[model samples]
Target: MIITDTHTHLYSEAFEADRDEMIQRAIDAGISRFFIPAIDSTYSERMLQLKRDFPEHMFLMTGLHPTHVKDDFKDELLHVQTLLKEHKYYAIGEIGIDLYWDQSTLAIQQEAFRQQIQLAKQCNLPIVIHCRDAFDEVFEILEEEKGDDLFGIFHCFTGDFEQAQQAISYNMKLGIGGVVTFKNGKIDQFLNKIDLKHIVLETDSPYLAPVPYRGKRNESFYIMEVLEKLSGLYQLSEKEIAKITTENSKAIFGI
Candidate 1:
């Protein structure tokens, strides 16, 4: 029963002290595949270094995250293009609208988001969307851009039943993370409407830890807690949840 963490910032500074040990913990717990999403050009070097450290287990994706879209976004996108041309990555992702922090960048974020979607289409790779308080806006663009040619996962998805179905219609799988385990996290209510096939597990570590550690920094090992919750929701065994979600992730990442 190998579990795959479909979205995680393992390169984030939050794990400096025990990064190696934490990864070992996850591996010890049977969480094997780790999908790494790029934030922007700035972190590309560090991301590459991570692959060097764990080539067999870690997979990388290249894209400019919406939150990182600045006045020089065009140039940043160019960097992403160059990086893609130079090497291979699993997908184009962690790219979407982030209106929670600064609404001023909404227009630019959408523009960058659309551009990255085109890039993903061009590369024939799936995407990992990072959505915040801009679901309507993101969905609007997805509605326009989605097709057989456009497909990906909605990373850290916590939307309602209707929204989940909408994302599936757009050829996306919902990335279920720690939020589903929270007592107040609403995805638990109608999650059964979605099958394990349309779902993938992740940690998004150093952020959004599951209940019992909700306010603390998250880690990939905690993904087990998410699997435990899903097992209960689907009335399946943990081993089955791990295998199915891992298979769902391989369907996306092609790992």
Candidate 2:
């Protein structure tokens, strides 16, 4: 069985100590493919190092994360552009709005999101969205920018059925992660109704670990927890869940 963690920050400082072991554990658990999302220029080294260490299993994306947008965002975008020109990337991501943290930068954040979307198109790659309490804002940009040329995953999707439909309309797959296991996660209630083909599994690791391991640092192997929940939701076997989600991920990352 093969499982794809379509979204994760294995390069995050949270995994600085035992990143190698965590990755091995995931590989041992049948969680092999990992799509790495870039946060900013600061993490480029760690992200690249992760790919070097796991060349066969890792794919990389370049972009400035929404939360990283600040007064010097123009400079950051230039840095992102430089990386895009210099390296091969599967997507432009972990980029979107995050109003949950602060609303003051909504203007700059929106601009950055739109600019990144344009960059993704220019790069001829998909995008991975990171939205938090900014669906309307995110949707507005998606509506304005989406096209047959643009497609990707809505990473860590935590919205309702309607939002899911909207994301699908924009050629975006819903990335299912640790939230499905939460008692109040809410996604579980409506997720079964969505087509499994439109869903992909992820841990968003070193964060958002599934139940039993909830509130703890997430690991890719724990993707099995997501698989178990999805199997029950789809009435499919774990292997089937693994195969289909992996294929779905391959479609997006083209790996």
lDDT of 1 by residue, 117-170 (tens): 999998889989999998899999999998898988999997889999999999
Candidate lDDT values, in order:
0.91, 0.91
Writing each residue's lDDT as its tens digit, candidate 2 over 28-100 gives: 9888899998899999988888888999999999999999999999999998888878877899998999999
* Global local distance difference test of model 1: 0.91
Clashes of 2: 0
Screening candidate 2 with a backbone cut-off below 3 angstroms (N, C-alpha, C), the clashing residue pairs are none
